[model samples]
Target chain A: GAGVSQSPRYKVAKRGQDVALRCDPISGHVSLFWYQQALGQGPEFLTYFQNEAQLDKSGLPSDRFFAERPEGSVSTLKIQRTQQEDSAVYLCASSLGDGSSTDTQYFGPGTRLTVL
Target chain B: DQQVKQNSPSLSVQEGRISILNCDYTNSMFDYFLWYKKYPAEGPTFLISISSIKDKNEDGRFTVFLNKSAKHLSLHIVPSQPGDSAVYFCAASRNQFYFGTGTSLTVIP
Candidate 1:
């Protein structure tokens, strides 16, 4: 089976520009998650979705970050105003069942966003 | 303040030696612990996980040990191979997830 996947493997955006990142979860996965990975650092959680409903978004860094999963399978992470600090790799993950800590998360290749 | 911390930035070991990566946490609420391996330009790949109830979990050459009292956990790889060289992340969870800075491991063949 195909694993989780993300689009725009690499992106360079001018400061203050808006950027939309896409994620394709594994077929039939019930849970989706977004994370940001800074250089030389591990990924930091951003938001989580169970189906089309976002269950937890406490990890979102700021108001500029918005995420959605209208169809439960595909998800998007949008940054309203890009900043040099927003430069990082955006990763997406999916799980088989409910969005629980016990469930194993499978990750995608990720989108490296560089805000200039 | 970061809840999870991997103090070591990098480590190197021979292919036949053991590689130990450590993680510490300040929160006692974390009930589940996980280890992930990542490569450059790629997302993290789940390696193994352990529940707070158990002290150890092993999968092939990889073993994870948890110490609730110390609020710490460690991952050990026996007879490390060149392919095993990658960045390892430590994650702890109760209802939400918290990740460490990650430790890069290099195995020389």
Candidate 2:
């Protein structure tokens, strides 16, 4: 079975430009999550989705960031007016069911976004 | 504020020796602790995990120990192999999971 996967292994964006990163969760996974990892740092949570409904988004940095999982399988994280600070690897993860303390999350390769 | 912290940025050990990675968290609400291993150009993979109720959990050569009193956890790898060299991340979860800065481990053969 294919694991979770993200598109555009690397993306270089100019400051103030908008960029969208996509993630494809594993088959039958019902819980999806997004995270940001800076150079030499750990991944920070961004948002979470259970099926088509977004359950938590408190991790999003600002209004410029938006995420959607409309069909409950594919998800997108869009950043508007990119800043140099936004440069990092965006990671996507999914679990077999609504992620609980018992479920383990499988991660994707991640899309590295570099804002110039 | 960083809730989870992995103080050691890097570590090196001789092959066949034990490697211990430590992590601490400030949030007392975190009940679940997880360890993830990552290699270059790849995403992190789940290694092992422990809940607050249990003090230890072991799988194969990997063992995770949790100390609720100290808000600390550690991952121990026995007879570390070259293939085990990679970045190890510690994560704590309450309602959501928080990750540490990560520790890079190198095994010298």
Candidate 3:
């Protein structure tokens, strides 16, 4: 079975531009998560979704960031007025069970966003 | 305020030797711990995990040990192979997950 997948393996954007990254979760996965990985650092949680409902979003850095999982399978993370600090790799993960810590998360290849 | 910390930025070990990676967390509420391995240009892959109730969990050549009192955890890989060289990340979770800075492991073949 195909694992979680993210679109645009690499994206270079100018500062102040808006960018949207997409994620496709595994088939039938009930839980989806988004993370941001800065250079040489671990991934930081961005937001989480259980089916079509967003359960947790406290990890989002600021108001410029917004995420949605409308159909419960596909998700999008949009960043408005990107800053140089926003340059990082955006990772997506999915799990079979509910959005619990006990469930193992399978990750995608990630989309690297570079803000100039 | 980094809750999870992996002090060692990098490590090198010979192939067929044991590799130990350590992690410490400040939050005691973290009950679930996980290890992830990542290769260049790829997302992290889940390795193993342990619950606070259990002190240790083993799968194949990989073992994860958790010390609830110290708020620390470690991942051990026996007979490390060249293919095992990558960045290892330790994560702690209560409701949401918090990850460490990650340690890069180099296996010399």
Candidate 4:
């Protein structure tokens, strides 16, 4: 089966610009999550979605970061007015269940965002 | 503050020998722990996991041991293979998951 995947493997944006990263979870996956990973650092949680509802947005750094999964299949993480500090690899993961089960999360290759 | 921690930044082990990776967490509420392996330009893949109620779990050549009282866990790979050389991350979750900085393991042939 195809695993989770992300588009635009690499993206370079100027400071104050906006960028949108996409994620395609495995078919039938009911849970999706986004994370940010700085060089040599572990990934940090961003937000989570179950089906079409955005459940947890507490991990989002600020208001500039937004995410949506309207149809319950694909998701997009949008960053408005990106900052140099936001430069990092954005990762997406999906699981079989909505955090209710101990199902392991399958991660995507990730999108490397470079903010100049 | 980091809830889960892989104190060792890197580890080196001779091929065919046993390699051990250790992790610790400060939050006692974490009931589930997982280990993931990652290669360059790739995402972290799930390796093995153990629930707090269980002290150990094994899969093929990999084994994960958890010590709930110490808030510590370790992954043991017997007969280490060169292909196992990569970054290994330890993660824990109560309601939300948290990952450690990760340890880069180099398996020498």
lDDT of 2: 0.96
Model 2 lDDT tens row, A1-116: 69998998999999999999999999889999999999999999999999999999999999999999999999999999999999999999999987886689999999999999
* Poorly placed runs, candidate 1 (over 4 Å): none
Best by lDDT: 2
lDDT of 3 at A29: 96
Residues B1-109 of candidate 1: C-alpha lDDT, one tens digit per residue? 8999999999999999999999999999999999999988778899999999999999999999999999999999998999999999999998877899999999999
* Candidate 2 per-residue lDDT over residues B1-109, each given as its tens digit: 9999999999999999999999999998888999999999999999999988999999999999999899889999998999999999999988788999999999999
lDDT of 4 by residue, B1-109 (tens): 9988999999999999999999999999888999999999999999999999999999999999999989999999998999999999999987778999999999999
- Please give, for residues A18-80, the per-residue lDDT of candidate 1 as tens digits: 999999999999999999988877788899999999999998999999999999999999999
User: Model 1 - which docking category?
Assistant: high
lDDT of 4 by residue, A1-116 (tens): 69999999999999999999999999999999999999988999999999999999999999999999999999999999999999999999999897643778999999999999
lDDT of 3 by residue, B69-92 (tens): 888899999989999999999999
Ten contiguous residues minimizing lDDT sum, candidate 4 chain A: A96-105
DockQ values for all predictions? 0.84, 0.85, 0.88, 0.72
By DockQ rank, best first, the candidates go 3, 2, 1, 4
Q: Please give, as one word, the docking class of candidate 4.
A: medium
Model 4: how far residue A114 lies from native, Å: 0.6
What range of 10 consecutive residues in model 3 chain A has the weakest lDDT sum?
A1-10
What does the lDDT read for residue B50 in candidate 4?
92
Error of 3 at B53 (Å): 0.6
Whichever of 1 and 4 has more DockQ, that candidate is: 1
